[model samples]
Target chain A: MHSFESLSKDFAAFFQKSHFPDQPASLYQPADYFLGLGGKRVRPVCCLMGNELFDEILPDTWQVATAIELFHNFTLIHDDIMDKAPLRRGMATVHSRYGEPTALLAGDVMLVVAYDYLNKVRSEHFHRIIQLFNRTAREVCEGQQLDMNFEKSETVSLDAYIKMIELKTSVLLAASLKLGAILGGAGEGNLHHIYEFGRNLGIAFQVQDDYLDAFGDPDKFGKQVGGDIMANKKTFLLIKALESADPALKAELDALLQSNHPDKVEKVLAIFRACGVDEWAKTLKDQYLSAAFQHLDDIAVLSKRKEPLRSLANFLVQRDY
Target chain B: MHSFESLSKDFAAFFQKSHFPDQPASLYQPADYFLGLGGKRVRPVCCLMGNELFDEILPDTWQVATAIELFHNFTLIHDDIMDKAPLRRGMATVHSRYGEPTALLAGDVMLVVAYDYLNKVRSEHFHRIIQLFNRTAREVCEGQQLDMNFEKSETVSLDAYIKMIELKTSVLLAASLKLGAILGGAGEGNLHHIYEFGRNLGIAFQVQDDYLDAFGDPDKFGKQVGGDIMANKKTFLLIKALESADPALKAELDALLQSNHPDKVEKVLAIFRACGVDEWAKTLKDQYLSAAFQHLDDIAVLSKRKEPLRSLANFLVQRDY
Candidate 1:
């Protein structure tokens, strides 16, 4: 199996070779800018890994990887607009640099372009790939809607938050792997198993993101460690804290959450520790990671062939930054 | 062949039967509202007409029609955001009512849903339909980008303006017809011919719109007659006047175009008449209409079977409002 770095290098080289039409600078320029901006390109790497698991990487795998990457970037462009974000990948966002209209158009064009690539797939794989892509795309939209809905919502359940993250972030990863598997000629059982592995790994990664937001060392996290707590985002930690705390502590936690205290992050951390929310999150993350590995193991492939994916899941779940 | 009214009625009824998922009101509700605040539903009607032309109306015709209609509404939602328009179909624009973020999300989901319906076609027709849809969709985006570019540009030629509108508006109509024809089992020759028919008819309709904006009776036009002139829009009339005027007349027209004169409409109309731009517009509209009819004539279908589409084209070109 190819190393993740090598697979990503191949994906980047393929991407560098890809060309966008140059006219109508308003539309394609922003698309080009956003795509050119650096990202981890995790989804495409996952897709490549999935393809390599069952067979030698096929020609169609690159097209599927390209489609997945374009679709991911398309979502980011629009999400930045919705989030009113000023910077993405340490650069001005599409909506911020280009106006919202053009950014919107860029994202729209990117989506159409993604389908353009997906349509290049062999006819034998066309129907399943498109159906999965359409379903996953719709779920992403639904997830975004739910996230927005939660902003106005006064109370949110841990289950609801998990579901939202699953829809928003996890499904695409799962779909990417499944698409690669399909193109790699994996059978139905293997396809489902690999998809579950991706989905579980995604959920585990998100939980790790939440846990690290509050507890990760500032030097290693690559972002402000307590940013989520500061913003009072409804992350897994807060949700679990809210769910598990007794009435008095719950009220105290709520006050700390809503307060403008300078030490608000410290206070929130204290409460999270007191309620064992940190431990709960750790346990949940491990459970999901274990579930991901089990799904990976269940695939009817050689143990040696699964090494790359297993290592990938370990890296994703165990990452510090 | 069925009358356009009957086909439209069936189309509308199919639309009424359509259901969008109700949860996450922030996303789906705006889509519901925008779609419910109806336009003429012209694209879907055209699609149905295309399907009816060569073969009996197939079940997939309605699905394609729904997809076209949904896609049209999606574009309108985003276009209204870019145009900053206050109303659509005599109702508040989606962004104005739902906020830009929600409206943006609504458009995104609508696009995904469009594919959900599109993916339902038999796999035999899937590749061709999706390819055509992707190409047309990208052209629409490019056209929108060019349109936005024109907003910043001071000297847009008539050719550029026509091409912009063709990409922004005409190709979708053309694609609508072609999609229906393909679903109706059209030969490639007939498909291309019908698409060309729609394309020419769309351009002719837009030119007629520009012409009527300057010259039609206020009572009959159903909109402010001089709205385009007042807004300094580079309509066909203005482009022609700019092109055809002598040096002195051109200087005068340029001054008139730039001034915020209360009688700007009258002044521009006078200049348009002096330069024979009205006649020019009429001639161009006729040429396009004639070209549209030629494509319709070239279709291998019987002339009697083509009558409904022919009448629809005539109705589109001749409408006073």
Candidate 2:
């Protein structure tokens, strides 16, 4: 199979060229502005890669690929409005530029159009795919709720944080892979295995992102590196730190977390490193990766057939930006 | 058939009870709060009333009924954000109280859950029901886009304004009735007729609202009378006034519309009265209502069976408050 990046880039071009065509001219400009503000196109690319690993199906699985990407954009537009995010993917967010009402409508149209693409799928898997679509959509919203609730909790347990991240961040990635696999005529068992692989890998990938945010080189990273530390966000590192902190060190950790100092990010990072929280996070990442690989191996597909999927996982986890 | 208000109340309560089964309660609280801060519950009640006009199939129709209500609330929460309105039903709007992010997420959840309710249909109508859901959902988004576009346009001619409000405000009501008719086992020809009745009636109701705002007594009206006039909003009266104005009168009307005086509400109302816009609005409302009644007459169902529906329309259009 080709590198996932090029495949995704091709689909991005295809998808962006023909979005929101049915919307009123002005009503659609916001969605168009957002589609132009591009991203890594990870989920849709994974969908294609997941299919390529099994079999080459329709060339126009690109429509299904576009559907996945469109759904992702829908979540992002709505989430940005909720998150009060001013910029996304290095450009002004749709809500920030066009106002919330337009963004909301744009997101809604994106979702409907997602099904428009899905409706093009011609397979026995259509019923199963629709069921999966509805279920994944519900879980995504559940994840958003969990993430919001975490913000209000003074103390989020490590398990709670993991569960929330899995729901909010990873399920769609997992769903994307399964969608591609099912579309490629993979059996239920193998499809479930691929989904498991994607789910675990996604969890590990997110933890690495949390780790890199504190330790990554800002020059290599596209955005600010210590954003989570600065916001006192309860990422894996923070959750682990809180869980493993001793009585004496707990005070120090809290002080660093609560500090208003300009060097708060550095100070929090130092405390986390000294307490071996980074080591613990690395261990957890490996555990998730191992579980993901185990699921990948358990698939009936041979080692040679799985190489591309593994490569995609490595690329996702090892990204600097 | 039950009163529209009672049926709506029942559906609202049922939906609230069925939403989420605990944990991170924030996810469902917004729905609870907004449903509790009730209004006429006009759309869903109409759907329920439409269902009862046929036979009492089963209580499952209430799920779709509640779904319509939830969909309406979802739009309102998002609309509140766009209009920057601080109050809803005499209480703080969702965005104002919980912040925009929560409101956005809440609205997102509400829309998804709306479909969950739609999917609760009896197996017989399930196939067509999904199609109806898709159409209704898409049209609502299209309407919202038109409404946003209207904000930027200066002229907003009578024909354009009529089309805008028809899409923005009427489709959902029409969809609700049509969906109920389908679930209630009405034939296609009859379904089409009911849709026209509801859609034309929705247009008429909006025109009546526009009329009431400019001419109704503040003491009798629950909301601030002439609220649309104060905002220089494009309403039936304003559009009519602008259309019928002579060259000098048109210039003065434009000036008043562009004014920022403290008494802009009363000022615009006086201009509308001077231009006989109220009479023009009433005439337009009557035209739509007459069209709506004509649609009811065209329905294949016996008029005796639709008497309840007629009384419902009278309650909507003929009532003062």
Candidate 3:
């Protein structure tokens, strides 16, 4: 079994080749530029890992993995425009650098190219993979819409927020694994377990992300420790703190949300600490982590074969950054 | 053989069913609303007609038909956003009514739903249909980018403009026919002929559309004559006139393009007429129409089976609107 680092490198090397035609540089260059900006390539690697769990990885798995990465970048481009974000991955976003219209079209063509890759998969696995992809893609859009709605909403229940996170963030991870497993010739039972494992792992990672933003060392995390707090962005810690805070504490948190004070993040962190949200967040992350492992364990594969995924999950959730 | 009108009604009835779920109203509602504002369901109906030309229309044809319509609307929503178009089908465009972010997501989900419908097609036909759809979709995006690029360009060649029009408008119509014909068990030769027929017909219709905007009676056209002129939109007449105009006429046209004069449309039309572009446009339209019919005649089907398509092509290009 390949480790996450090794598989990520393989995926990266494979993906270094361009997926788009060079013409209409106005439209495609931005797409190429954004893909070049690069990330950990975690989702595509997850796909490879999923395939490896079942059998020696097939050629089709690489095609699907490319599709997942392209689809993920498509979402990021459009999401950046919608969010009016200026930077991503510590650089100018596609919209910021290339302008919104080009960025929008770039995102669109990336999606089309992603499907072009999917269509290249051998026909026996093509229909099921496309169907699962469609469902997951639609859910991701719905999740984005819900996330936007939550911003204007005065109150969002924890359950609703979690659902949004699942739709926006987790399902793609889950679907990536499932897509690879489908191509790997896994049976239905193993498919479900792998998907659940991915879904739960994604949630745990997100929780840990939120926890790091609030509490981790800034130098270690490589981001401002309270950037989410400063923006009044919704995250697990803030949502849970709202739900569990006393009336006085809730009022203070609300005021902090309304302020542009320099101390806002510090004050919010204090309220969160006062309400035990910090500890609660860790507990929530552990719960999801355990659920993830439980699902992973239930998969009908030799435990030794699962080591790569096991270590990957640990690396994802146990990180400070 | 189904007449375009009859098949249109059939498509309308089938499409009255919602393609999106209700939970995320912000995302799905704009999509639903945009689909509700009916245009002539030309592309989907073309799919059905293509099916009938080879054999009895199959249930798979309807599914592919739905996919075509959904995909077409998906483009319109995103295009409207990119163009900042306020109105569509005599109503507010999706972005104008629902806001850009929601509209963006709506378009995204609509595309995903389109694939969902396509995935419902039987596996034997699914792979071919998806490959064609992806290629056509990518060309459409490239065409849109080229159209936008032409807006800022000081000069656009007639040949380049025609290619852009083909990409932006003609290919989807062509692919719609090809998709249906594939499902109808069309042999490869007939598939090429039908696609070419649709392509040439689309170009002819677009030329006629530009002609009507410049010269047709507003009462018949149902749009203000010279609206494209007011927008300084590049059309066949304008581009061709620029290419063929003498130096003096060219200077006049250039001046008109820069001004927002109330008589700008009249001045541009006068230059177009002086260059004999009006007559040239008529000849050009006829050239494409004749080519379309030639391909239609070439299709290896009973001549009688070709009547509906031939008449529909006439109705499209010959109409003032």
Candidate 4:
């Protein structure tokens, strides 16, 4: 079985050699710029692994992988605009560097280009692939809407938050794996199993992201630790703290959440730890990881063939960044 | 041949009976609101007419038509945000009524829904339809970018302006007809003919819109006469005036274009007439219409079968509103 590191290297090489149209400098330059600002490329790598697990990596699989990457970047561009985020990947965000209109168009063109790649798949696979993509795309938008709604919300249930994260982050990852499996000629049952594996893995990944943001070493994490806390973002940590705190502590937590306290991150972390929210988050992450592994085990593929995915999942669960 | 009136009525019924999902209220509501505001339904009608000109209207034809309509509205919503326009179809624009972020998502979901409709086409037609749609979609973005670029530009050539409008306004209309033609099982030659027909007709329609904006009576036009002139839009007339004017008259025209003169519309109109730009615009519009008819005539289908499209073209040419 190929290691995750090898698969990621292959994805990087393929992406590096990929050609994005250079004309319409206004619409595409920003796309090129954003795509060049590299991330971990997790979704596309998962897609490749999904495909390779069932069959030899097909040409259409690469196309699907690239399309998913583009789609992810498209979401990032638009989400940054909505969130007013200044940076992505330690660089200026698309909307911040390019004006909002250009960023919007760039994001839009990315979607069109992504579909263009998907359209290149064989006709037999085209309809199902496009349908899955459209449904997932709509769900992502709905998830973004729900996330925006949460900003003004007074209290958010853990279930609602989980649902939002599932829609926003998990489903795409799930769809990515299913699409790859579909291209790889996996059975319907296997498709569902791989999708569930991806979905649960994505949730665990996001919860871990929240945990890392508050508790991780800043140097290793490669992001500002407690940035979410400083912004009073309704992450899993904050929501759990709100839900589980006693009245006096709840009032204190609420005041801190509402305040521009310079030490807000420190204060919020203390509250979370004091309330056992930190430990709770770790437990939640572990539960999701276990569920993900269960789904992975349920797939009918040989355990040897699944080793790459299993190892990748373990790596994700233990990653510092 | 079906009458344009009947085809349009059919389109209206189809659109009215169509269901857009009601959930994700933030995302879909603005889409519904935008689609609900009735325009002429021109693109979809063209699609239907294209379908009827060849074969019986197939299920896929309506899907293509709806996809085109949705795509057009998607462009409108995003364009409104970019242009900061306050109105569309005599109502507040999507971004104006819904906030920019909601409007952005609405446009995005509309595109997804558009693809969803396109996805329903038979796999035989799916790849070609999607490829064409993607190309046209990218061109539209480039065209919008060029239009925005022109806002900061001091000089825009007549050719450049026409190219921008062709990309911005013409291709989708062309693509709509071509998609319908493809679904109707039209030959490759006929598809090209119909696409050219739509393209030339769209350019003529836009030039006429510019003409009516400057020359038509406001009561008949149903829009403010000289609104483009008031906004200092670089219409066919304006560009031609700039290209053809004598030095003294050119200086005067340039000064008037730059001024917020109360009688700016009258002054610009007078200058355009003096420089024969109005005449040039009419001649250009006529040239496009004639070219459109030539393509329509070239279609191997019987002339009688082509009457609906011809009639629609004529109505577009003579439209005051």
Candidate 5:
């Protein structure tokens, strides 16, 4: 079985072929620019891992991986516009670099190109793969709408937030694995286990991401500590703090959220610590990680064949960053 | 053979079922709302007509028809946002009424739903249908981008404008017909003829639309006369006039385009008439309509089976409006 790192390199080499045409440079160039601003390529790698876990990876798996990556970037471009975000991965976002109109079109064409890639995949399960993709794509949009709704809302339940994260962040990851597995000729029973594995691993990774943003060493984490706190962005820690804090501490946390004080991050961190949110976040991450491992264990594959996915999951959630 | 009017009614009835879920009303509601604002279901009905031309309409044709309509509406929602159009079908555009962010998501989910519908079709040629849809979708995006680019450009050539219109308007219509024909067990040759028929018909219809906007009575046209001229929108007549007019007339047209004078429409109309653009538009429309009919005649189907499409084409381009 191929390791994540090896497969990632393979996917990168394969993806270097441009997905868009040269003309209408205004529409396609921004899409190319954003795709060029590479991330970890985790989702596409997850697709490859998903396939490898079931069987020798088929040629169609790479196409599915490429589709997943393109779809992810499409969401990011549109989400950045909706969020009015200026920067992504420390570079100007598509909307901020190109105009909003062009960015919107760019996101659109990326999605179209992603489907074109999917259409190129020749698999017995092509129809099912497409159905899962459509459902997941719709859910992601719903998740974005719900996230935007939460910004305007005064209160959001933990269940609601978790649902949003699953829809926004987890399902695509889960779907990627399932897509690959589908192409790999995985049986229905194995498909369920791998999908659950991805879903839980994704949630655990997100929890770790939130925890690191607030508390990890900035040098190690590769981001400014407590940046979410400074932005008054709601994360798992803040939500837990609000739910678990004593009345006085809750009032203080609310006040901190209202102000842009110089010490706001420090103050919020203190409150999070006081309410045991930082510790709770770690425990939550561990619980989801354990559930993920349980699902991975339940898969019908030999334990040896599952090693790459297991290692990748560990790397994703165990990282300080 | 189904008349366009009958097929249109069938499409409307079939489309009465809501395309989205109730949860996250923010995302789905705008999409539903946009679809509710009725326009002529031209493209979807064309699908039905195309199917009927080859054989009795199949069950899959309705699904393809639904997909085409949803895809068309998706483009309209996003285009309305890009154009900053406040009104559509005499009501607030999706972005203006629901907000840009929601509107963007709405358009996205509508597209996802469109794919979902397409996935429902049980066709032997399913893969080819998807490929066609994907190609057309990408071309439409490129077309929109080109249209936006032209708005900022100092001058746009007639060929460039025609290409834009073909991409933006004609291809979808052609694809709709082709999609239906594909499902109705059309041989390859008939598919080409029908697609070309739709393409030329679409161009002719657009020419008529441009002409009606400039010279038709407002009461008959159901829109303000010369609305395109007032907005300084580049159209076939405007481009043709500029190309054909003497230097003095071209200067007058240029100055009028630069200003929002109360009589700008009248002045431009005068220049257009002086340049014989009004008469020229009629000849151009006939040229395209004849080409469309020629292709229709080339289809292997009985000539009687071609009546509905021929009549629809004539109705589309020959109407005063």
Candidate 6:
């Protein structure tokens, strides 16, 4: 039984350096600049943990794992351009520092290079792997499009938002787990259960992000809080608030939301508290976490090997920032 | 043998129809808007022609031929954004009409779906086909980056621009031909020679674009002459003009380029013509065409089957519009 903590810690250092070919200069600096921006390596870690649960190791495991990282960074680079985000990992966003044209092409090349690594997978499994890669890649793009589409619509239903996030964010996490299982020759039933666990956890994790960005403590959060409220973005909190609010409360919320002043953040937070929106968001987050655990429990693996997966999910949902 | 005329008519008509799942309604609306604006599908037609030269009665050949067209449209969508070009095919460009964000994502998805077809290739040849696709994709990105870099710098050597176009534009054309050849199961040696032939022809085609944009008939060409010069773009004409001009001539050309006045197009055209820049550009275009022909001659296939390819290149190079 490997604790997910142990697996994650190992995979956290996953792809610590370039694994294939003569590397090129990042053209900006540190070819791994964004790569080193520490993500939990959560998705790829799911891959390795799934592999371990199946008790198999494929050589060039790093190739696929590193590819997940490449795909992730590539998405981030383009998403930053779309989101107009200025900072990532406490550094200037690639588009902000290097300009959009460079950022776009850098992201483009990273995706192509990701395939270069995938090409090295053993021939026996190669077709299945490439098929998985293609399907996952398309889902990620579809997810992104849906995410963008959510922004333009005047109203987004809570269920639709969850589905959007699940596709946009969770499916990659799901794909990461499934990919490792396929590589490890895991049985079909196990792959199905593992995918469910990863997808549910991914949704829970993003709900955590939405909650943390709004309600997190200033110092502990590691960045400014209430970014969702400030951007007037319709996250779980806002969508729920919109759905549940009485007419008067809804009017007040909309007014505060529409205000041009900086004090709008305080006004909205005050309304959310008065209406119990904060508690509601927290309760929903916990509900997702509970559902994810049930899915994890349903996996055929022994209780012991699943412990790590459970702990990782708990850590994510319970995070302060 | 398919005549160049028949090949162009055949592939363009084939590509005009809709295929593929998950394409946004807005996706290839630009293709219609752009493709309808009417430049020759010379590269794709060459792919079909090249494939037939190796073997007649090509199987499900349209799919491979259409993939090349899709890839070409992907490049144009992104390039129009980068160039900030207001028009294509003599109509409003994708970015200009649909807005940048839509153009960006639609272009991204177009590439993904390009591979969706590649995945549909017969299982035996799929690996080889995808590897070629991956290599071509990366080179195109590198070529685009180098091009963006040139826009910021003063000196863009003719050799540098040639290399840039080779990656940016030519290899995809080469790859298109190779993709068809691979689908036809042409020998590796034959594929390489065909690739060279297509690549050189692409370079020659681009040079012809530069030549005509300056020197072609404006009424017949359906656009302003010397527009690239007016924008101070680092096209071959400007590069040749810069390289060939004396310091006094260089200063005059530079001064004419600096003021992008309405009259400046007329002024730059005068200087370019007076200095024989058009003739220099035409001479290079002819040289590239000759090189392309020499490569075509290297092919083991009989000259009879090769007529469509040679005429296609000539039609592309010699077209007034």
Model 4 residue A115 distance off true place after TM-score fit, in angstroms: 0.9
- Candidate maximizing DockQ: 5
- The DockQ of predicted model 5 stands at 0.88
Every candidate's DockQ is: 0.81, 0.48, 0.87, 0.83, 0.88, 0.47
Candidate 5 lDDT score relative to the true structure: 0.90
TM-score of each candidate structure, all chains considered together? 0.95, 0.88, 0.98, 0.97, 0.98, 0.90
lDDT of 5 at A170: 95
* Model 3 segments more than 4 A misplaced: A319-321, B319-321
Q: How badly does each model clash, as a count of residue pairs? A: 0, 1, 0, 0, 0, 1
lDDT of candidate 6 over A259-284, digit per residue (tens): 86778877777877777878877777
Which digits, one per residue and each the tens of the lDDT, describe model 3 over residues A1-321? 889999988999999988999998899889999999989999999999999999999999999999999999999999999999999999999999988989998999899899998988984877899989988999999899999999999888999989999999999999999998888889999999999999999999889988999999988888889999998889999999999999999999999899999889889999999999998888889999899999999999999989999999998898333
Cα deviation in Å at residue B208, candidate 6?
1.9
Which scores greater on DockQ, model 2 or model 3?
Answer: 3
The residue-by-residue lDDT of candidate 1 on B23-75, one tens digit each, is 76767878898888877888999988898897888888788788888888889
Tens digits of lDDT, candidate 2, B119-237? 55654676566667667777777777777777778867888777777777888888888877887888878888899998888888988888888788778767788788777788888
Pairs that clash in candidate 1: none
Comparing only chain B with the true structure, the TM-scores of all models are: 0.97, 0.93, 0.98, 0.96, 0.97, 0.88
The CAPRI-style docking tier of model 2 reads acceptable
What is the C-alpha lDDT profile of model 5 across B21-64, one tens digit per residue?
Answer: 99988888788899999889999999998889888999988998
Error of 1 at A2 (Å): 2.3
List model 4 lDDT by residue over A145-239, tens digit each: 99999998999999999999999999999998888888888898899999999999999999999999999988888788988988889999999
lDDT of 2 at A180: 85
lDDT for A166 (candidate 1):
97
- As for lDDT, the candidate ahead, 1 or 2, is 1
Q: Could you tell me the TM-score of candidate 2?
A: 0.88
Interface RMSD of 1: 1.0
**What ranking of all candidate models by DockQ puts the best one first?**
5, 3, 4, 1, 2, 6
Between prediction 3 and prediction 6, the one with superior DockQ is 3
